[model samples]
Target chain A: MALPTYAGPLERTWYYAFRTICGLIFFFLIAPLVVIVPLSFNAVPFFTFTQEMLTLDPAGYSLKWYQDFFGNLNWHGAVKNSFIIAVFATLISTTLGTIGALGLSRAEMPMKTTVMAILISPMIVPLIISAAGMYFFYSKIGLAATHIGVIIAHAALGIPFVVITVTATLVGFDQSLIRAAYNLGASPTYTFFKIIVPLILPGVISGGLFAFITSFDEVVVVLFVGSYEQRTIPWQMFSGIREQISPTILAVATLLIAVSIMLLASLELIRRRGERLRGITPS
Target chain B: MAAATTSDGALTTADGIPLKASLARAERRNRNRALLLVTPLFAFILVFFLMPIFDMLTRSVDNTVVGSVLVRSVPVLSQWDDSSGELPSEAVFKAMVLDIQDGRETRTIGKVGTRMNYEKSGMTSLFRKSGRRAKQIKEAPYKEALIKLDKKWGDINTWRLLKRESDAQTLTHYLASIDMRFNDSGEVVRQPEEKQIYINLFIRTLKLSALITVLCLVLGYPISYLLATLPVRTSNLLMILVLLPFWTSLLVRTTAWIALLQKQGVINDFLVGVGLIGDDGRLAMIHNAIGTVVAMVHILLPFMVLPLYSVMKTIPPSYVRAARSMGATPWTAFWRVYVPNTVSGIGAGGILVFIIAIGYYITPALVGGVSGTLISNFIAQHISVTLNWGLAAALGSVLLALVLALYILYDKIVGIDNMKMG
Candidate 1:
């Protein structure tokens, strides 16, 4: 935390000023999440900013809402359905994207830019148009209200994230390594698994995490394709907010934020390991 | 080569030359593998995404409702386009009565009428109730029959609806989306000089998006610079905090802001405690432009931060140090050396936030009341509440064009070369 050797009086003043400014921005960025962490512990039903006292009030904190979210059948069902959809969509999108990234990045193909753009187009186009179109088509096929329908719909939305992340990782990839494996008489499949996959594993995992979260958070498409039983947690939360302002949503939101922070921490960890394993030094 | 020889032995010679002579064959095989890898994505997008959009766009010109069912009665209706240029011919009126009586109505004039009505109002029920009374046109006197229905029908507006029914190929929906309606001669006319129309909404949405983009740049630039200059460990931790909300469900984040911004929410509670305003004074947080700005800025802050951070991280400290060593003040050095370098991130982040903000449905829908509704909310209304795809598609198409236009404009102003998005 010490200032560098070249620091002068004015430079020292500027350093403190910069640090203070950065610290304030950091607080502002994290303040909302921080606010929710404490509020979730409030025992009272009303969601006031701070509890009764300035001191720590464990009496105001109870596990009732968390218990309610778990014990309630609707919340549990939605959570289960969200996990199911997110998992399937994640696997499908990540697999497809990884393969596409491998081919686009490694193959000596024509029109690579065109292919990459086409592959990444889903991310740019608005989902509402896609949702409207899918609703009509899926209705005709009688798949509009099915769980499979929503999963496929969400997977299409998530694919671009996987493609973007994996492609970026592939930019640093050493394709000759795969050729080296093949020269050793390892089959193409074996080389792929042992060589290419390991090198790009961080990108793949990070991309998969992004894909999973994208599908998990998606609401508009699910609203079009998913029915009551197929409702995910976001959709349930959406309806809950619309029907009434429930503090229980706050409890759920806080839990989700915590889980997201955990996931992000793991993703960052995976990325660091990935960079180290691939011998690609980070800034 | 050995793997290929073993795996594809049938296609290769003993000398390891493939049966195909040209590199084109290898190219073809590679292309096929590439195709195989990309096919799933293309097919998924095609079937689930593209096909549906095409179907929705098709609704724009789908005049089947008027073309098929009402063709038989048009002859009689054409006769009434005489002298007064108002009422339909008596025989056509009689035919409509019969058509209404038979209940096997072929034309979906009803659907068209309802579609137009949602973009405005007083259409479906107005038209449906009147259409049902065709039989009464014969029994009752013509004036009585007309009076019984909407008096607006007695006016020229009724003829306008009927005329819309008469046209087999109509661009009325497209025109209406731009807040234009067909004049009596079927020329495009602005929807009165007074009432706010879709054209205004289009402009408003753009203006609102631009305002938010500017707000984000103002709020995000300094933070991004600071994050960039900090030690990597500290900056990375800060960056994660910024990105933390992105991992949570967007719906949850928007609603959390809603809880915080509501009249009885934390913001209002704080304002009241501080005597910023009376308890009963307008919170004016949610359900207005203020709420829209707050929620959108929060949702989009990470987008602005990430790009700026990446750009700043790449920038060397020497530029600023040199500026300072040359007798420049710290602020001057920052403004001259650091700020210009960060413009690329600023532009990239601005575009990202603006485009995403325009299409936002949840935040605007939740926090923005009537005054703050964006174009997406109307698109949702068309598809879900009104079940009008033509208008929805037209509105959606307009939004798509606006976003695309902004992209090109941003590229022009900022020079896409400057962008170094991570």
Candidate 2:
């Protein structure tokens, strides 16, 4: 139900109290992020407000931190590593997860619920257990501390997100379309590529985006399975803070935040388009 | 015409007109295609997911030293008063002592001690000493030597811990992690009153999780409500704002808090500038519970808001108006009506926040000083610093058990299937 915005005197007071409290909290939630965007371009390096210093003071407006972030080999390496791992992991997880979703959606497989639960368990199970286990198992096969090791580990973690998003999209899918394609003598592979893939492209893309983000942002698992050569941005950021808190990290954070916002916006667009493709308008 | 049709039907029985075999082959091909489609995923899971969990569970019961040592002393230790939890026969104790000592001399004690220390402290030294010079227990001067090693040896509790260890299988590591000890008489009992630990840490973790969950809900609920009600454009913008932090890495966010919350950091600077307290008054933000709560809440609020918003969006406004028109005051209407309807959302959000908070490691380690560290921190220490996988696994098992228990309870109370927060 639409919440009551106004009421009798006591009710009105309660309403205002709730709204005021909510507004304050909303500000608190967004404040840290908001602070970073401006601080990224701050004339002064310190996080503070100053009076009447809008124009580029010779020292204040320097983009040296940003320059260092892009120019430093360490930072550049981390960024490249993160993107490579994220892209590869996302592709593997989205492809497998979508195929799994299609199979489960159409068939009345035995123990279907259990299979689904098992697929999603990675999301629920604590990372430490998984990380420790992976460490031991991977070490035996000489996969530990390798880039391929980190990618497989991340893809495992990313698989659940892909499954969840793609499953949701597949829920309302029509079976009759598949039957029609079969009736027209189209091969199943041809039908999937020409019909099902385009129909569920939104779900697939959204799922892929989440998988990419999940792998990009993951640190705890990477921390265990990876060593120096495979360090991603978050892992680097972690050590950066531990060793020294430089403004260069701030520059990195601001850049990462910008990239994340752009990715999320694109995801939202994909969601909107998928909804439209499915003939469901945004409410 | 009828006679001709009958003759034609009789002639059409076999190969020329039928495509049944082709249809059957096509179905077989479809089945094979499905199998081909799913095999890659199955291979990935087998290699990556299932194998790891199998390895982890194996470590849970991995009793390598005790297993190898079983044949050497099981028969000799047989004569001891196991029920009294009394110290075993001198020979058996001697064998154990020698084993422990030899284990120590060969540095096997360190490896075996990893499992025993998980049960209780000082076990490695006791076992190593007994193994090396255990035969001396038969000598007349045994009491003095025993007492010299540990004054508690004179008491039955100490002997009880030893007697408990004689078993072929060991729960000592698992039980001791939770602060329960075996009585010498061989019954499991609460760790003697003085040594009970980890319980408090577990409690503290729970309380911390509850506190963080509450803080997130208190802060996130109204914003979620507002976001749900705002014009679509505005709500979408606000939602993006909520999700902005999520795009960045968690390590980055926790580090950001470190930058913001340090003693000479912006928070302290702001407090000093505002005259809230003296310039000398350093606000205890990071390196303590306050810092942990603040940083955690900031990171976890999105979990709360997204669920709350999804639930809030579907709720039509007409219910509130209907309540208002039917002789109910607005305040009464909201308190009785709106809030209860939002319970599912709150429940979904609370569960998500609590589950995530319990598994928190990085934020607590980075921001939480000794006093602020949670149980997961100790589990990490057991693995990383101490290289004690047995204890680490036991502690992890405990944490895993608790999380699973809470999950089961939550599911029973409000079916997990009924809750969704994306």
Candidate of highest TM-score = 1
Chain A TM-score, candidate 2? 0.92
Q: Chain B alone: TM-score in each candidate?
A: 0.81, 0.77
- The CA lDDT at B402 in model 1 is 71
Report residue A228 deviation for candidate 2 (angstroms). Answer: 2.1
Against the true structure, candidate 1 reaches a TM-score of 0.88
Over A1-283, each residue of candidate 1 has an lDDT whose tens digit, in order, gives 3577877898899788867876776676666666666666667665556546235766767778788788889898899999999999999899988887777775665677666655665666677767777887888888799999988888888887888788888888887887789889999889988988888888888888888888888888888888888899998888888886566777898988878978888987887798677676864
Worst 10 residues of 2 chain A by lDDT: A47-56
Q: Cα deviation of B337 in candidate 2 (Å)?
A: 1.8
* Candidate 1 ranges beyond 4 A from true positions: A1-18, A50-58, A281-283, B1-21, B74-95, B104-127, B130-160, B165-169, B274-278, B407-422
Which residue ranges in model 2 land beyond 4 Å of their true spot?
A1-19, A38-58, B1-43, B69-109, B113-168, B183-187, B192-195, B408-422
Compared with the true structure, what per-residue lDDT tens digits does model 1 show for residues B190-255?
Answer: 877775478888887888989988977877887787677767777776777677865667776787
The CA lDDT of each predicted structure is 0.75, 0.74
Per-residue lDDT tens digits of candidate 2, residues B379-422? 78876788777667777787877777767666665554344323
